[model samples]
Target: MAENIREHLRRLLSVPPGKGKPVFLFWLYFFLVITSYYLIKPVRDGLFLEHLGSGMLPWFYLLNTGLGLLVVCLYNQVRRRIRAVPFIQTIGCALILVFFGFRFLFGTFPALAASLFHSWASVYNLVVVLMFWSFADDFFSLDEGKRFFGFIGTGGVLGGVVGGWLAGLLAEILGSANLLIVSSGVLFLGLVVVQILGMAVPSRRGKGLADDQEGEQLGSGFGFASLYRSPYLRLIAVVVTLTMLCTTLLNLQFNRGVELAGFNGDELTSFFGSFYAWMNASALGLQVLVVGPVNRRFGPLPGLAVLPLICFGVFADGLFAASFSVLVLGYGAALSVLYSLNQSSRELLFIPLGIEEKYRAKAFIDVVFFRLGDSLAALAQLLLVSTALFGAAVLQVLGILVSLGWLITLRVLQRQTS
Candidate 1:
């Protein structure tokens, strides 16, 4: 078994590097975006809490979040020829949302105008990230991914660590809105970097278009029908999606748990900074050590599905008996490791999927299904927090059900594999 695993690792890593031109460009532009958006990420969370205050009923925030996510999703689906079209679209939409909301609310609560502005700005940056990674996945071949994968992820990890630390330090001085402006400016720089890289070295990876193997051809709005046709890809998507949803539930609960434990403001922001940095850093570490090896140790499908199945019961505990310490120490650390491991391996396996599935279907899962999961979890929490129909105990029960669904999804995957 050990010998076989080593051989598998060799095959995965043996792929030749990208014509460093495109990969180089990707590295340069990708991390810059990290530095840019991360500049605001830590500070923004605190501000979001401040604005929402105790009044942030789950539905109220969830409703706006869902609504905003919908608009962002639509905008994301809209593609244009100008390569930079999406970047501009994201930033422009954020600007419009901020300006409109601020103008309407500034008179009544002038202080919060910038807060609202920064809040939406964070959304815009997230859209950029979701799209950028999808674009990278679409543009790079599996072989190319093997070579550049670690290096590319390394940039984001470093940027996040630095950005998180900066926010922790700058909370009172630069203020959250200023951090947002900085993040926005960094994003603008990212847009510029992508364009420069696009022109300097055009992407030479295979087009996302497909042959009859996938139900439809690519470049046709991600060939949605053909995308799901691959039972393999479909199962991957389901597992990948459920994992993402679990991540959201863990993250939201973790933060709320922190505050419930009586930490706030700069201290809270610092804690977040530490948490996010560790998560990203840990993912990078696993890519080097565990991910590829584990996938080879277990088949791709089983490797992909196993983590969440095992973790579901462990994580389900957070919904009920969770506290700030327990949340951070147990759920936060455990889930972060789980997420990082799952994401790294999932990326490895995704290389085998059809190109359309790689780009389009992956995009839908990353943004829509992923957010759909988050919104649903939020709704669940909303009901629990608000009415009498449910509670944290119910959330634990639901998580158990999702876990069972996870196990069944694995059976479906194994059947497809046969």
Candidate 2:
């Protein structure tokens, strides 16, 4: 009976024989990476609110954009020199050290630490996730990606559920600052998983050009030149930008609501932790029940369309309702789709590109462009709020407009890819 159940699970995920070990390793690797980030996410936000307040979030967003560009540039340089596995391992080690360093600094300079940690957390999550998918793109063939990426992505969703729950429980017991140590340990475990994964999938490396050849292919353009050169990439950039714009607007509104509700310190941390836990729990359901079947049946284009349509409805409703519950439902639903269907679909789009473009261009789009959209949204928020020129209803309208733009761009991209 147990063996029969295993066979049924394999058939459901469409896992090819002899591919189980590598797929499971990749899944575990993603699980560890996301788990570590979720642990830090709530702590990062709560500490930022406690020390810096929500008003400063926009400046930090701008700071994150700059830092994200620098990191991607550095990442491109390093990636050109090393194999994918070593590059990921090196990043994992560096992140572990950074977390430990922050843990120490929090003792003496917490406000400053909180300020810096916010930007670090933002950049850190983006970089690690980009690296994982870039590596995955290298590892899996296009046909295999269509078959397996959704299942692989389910690992991250499950990780988010577990990590968020642990975060809520741990924040109460360990206090928010000490949660950094716990995250550091989780990252260290992630590094170990990376090592094991590297060994288990040794043959998958070097599918791209050799180190020197890849560097030359990447050229002096770094990543921007690729974006300039490719219409498909440009469309993706626009989609990402509009998506992040809507996301940032929704997040700011949610944070405002949370702030006004009068929670502080660990209570605030616990609240965010629970929020993420529930949100990711919803995401897990979508990943299991929605993403795979939708992608397999209609292909990724339809899956890609889901988030914008949902956002459009949610924001359109928000314009009428304009309540905390509306913000909660809207943001939660947006994120649930974003993390599940949207993520799997977006990563599938990269499978057709060349290795140089996969690593360099993708890093730019995911990190730099992702943060560019975020910063622009943050700047817009700051201006509107500071000037009192627009109301929350106006922001809702903007979100609705952005969602429509996202849908239109996705339509164009779908046509191009088709």
Candidate 3:
């Protein structure tokens, strides 16, 4: 009966025949990387709110934007020399060192230390996940991606649940600062998973480069040139930008709500952590039980449309009240739907592109353009907050408008890709 149940789940999840091992390895990698990152995410949010206040986050977002551009440029250069796995390992090592440095400095100057960690964590979370997608694109065929990507993504969602719950449980005892060491440990374990993948997957060697990747040179000029040249890429950039705008606005509002709810230190950390756990748990269930079957039956369009549709319905009802429970449910629904359905669809959209476009141009879209959108959204939010008149309500309206644009972009993108 147990074996039969296992087979049933395998079929339901659309696991490809004879590809179980590779899929599991990919799942493990995704799980480890996201677990490491999510462990820090809530802690980072709590620290920033405690030390910098909710209003100052726009400055950090702007700082992250500039730093993200620099990192993208440097990453493009570094990828020219090193393969994907080694590059990931190097990043993990550097983050481990940085966490230690933060730990030492946190004793004397908490705010400055937390600020630096916040910026770095933002970059770390996006870049690592994007790199994994890039690696997967190089290794898997388009057909395989459509079938397996959703299932693989569930691992990350599950990881988020675990990491968030663990952080919540540990926050009181370990404190938010010590969570840095825990994050570093998980990241190192992720690197070890990468090494295992290096040995287990034969075609995964040499940075998971595709056959067409042979002639592509590394002097890609931040990938903006290709992005400007391709209409498809431009549309994707716009979608990313608008999505970031909506998310940033929602996040700012959520943070303010949390602050107003008046939780501090360990209480704040645990609250955010449990909130993250619930969101990701919902995302995990959707990815496992809904997204894969939905994609198989209807295609990526429905999956792509889910988030914007949810946003339009919820945010359009009334003003965004800055309260703990309301923010929890609102942001939770938005994030869960976005991460489960929208993210899986977005990653699969890259499958048909060339290797250079997939890795380099996609990097620009994922890292630089995404952060640029965050920066712009943060600036907008900053201006609204400064005016001190109906800031949260206006932001909710902006989110609704952005969601409408997102739906239109999805329609166009589907037509073009189809």
Candidate 2 is scored at a TM of 0.84
Q: Candidate 1 at residue 87, lDDT?
A: 55
lDDT of 3 by residue, 1-418 (tens): 9778757867886776767767878888899888888888888899889988998888888988888777766765566576667777787788789878888888889988878888888888867886787677656887888788867877888889988998898888898888879988887887887777667764443543553254344335547888888999898888888877877777887788888888988788888888889999998888778877887797777788877776665566536443456556878888998887778778777878997788678866877677777987888887876568554678778778888988999899889888
Q: Write the per-residue lDDT of candidate 1 for residues 303-403, one digit (tens) a residue.
A: 56656664574566665555455556655455545655666666665566666567666655565566566677677776665577655567566666776
TM-score of 3: 0.82
Which has the higher TM-score value, candidate number 1 or candidate number 3?
3
lDDT of 1: 0.60
Q: Which residue window of length 10 is worst by lDDT in model 1?
A: 211-220
Ranking by TM-score: 2, 3, 1
Q: Candidate 1, TM-score vs. the true structure?
A: 0.74
Candidate 1 vs candidate 2: which has greater lDDT? 2
Question: Which regions in candidate 1 have their CA more than 4 angstroms from the true location?
Answer: 1-22, 54-57, 60-78, 85-122, 130-146, 188-192, 195-199, 202-234, 305-316, 319-321, 348-359
The lDDT values for all models are: 0.60, 0.82, 0.79
Task: Give the count of colliding residue pairs in each prediction.
Answer: 2, 0, 0
- The CA lDDT at 385 in model 3 is 63
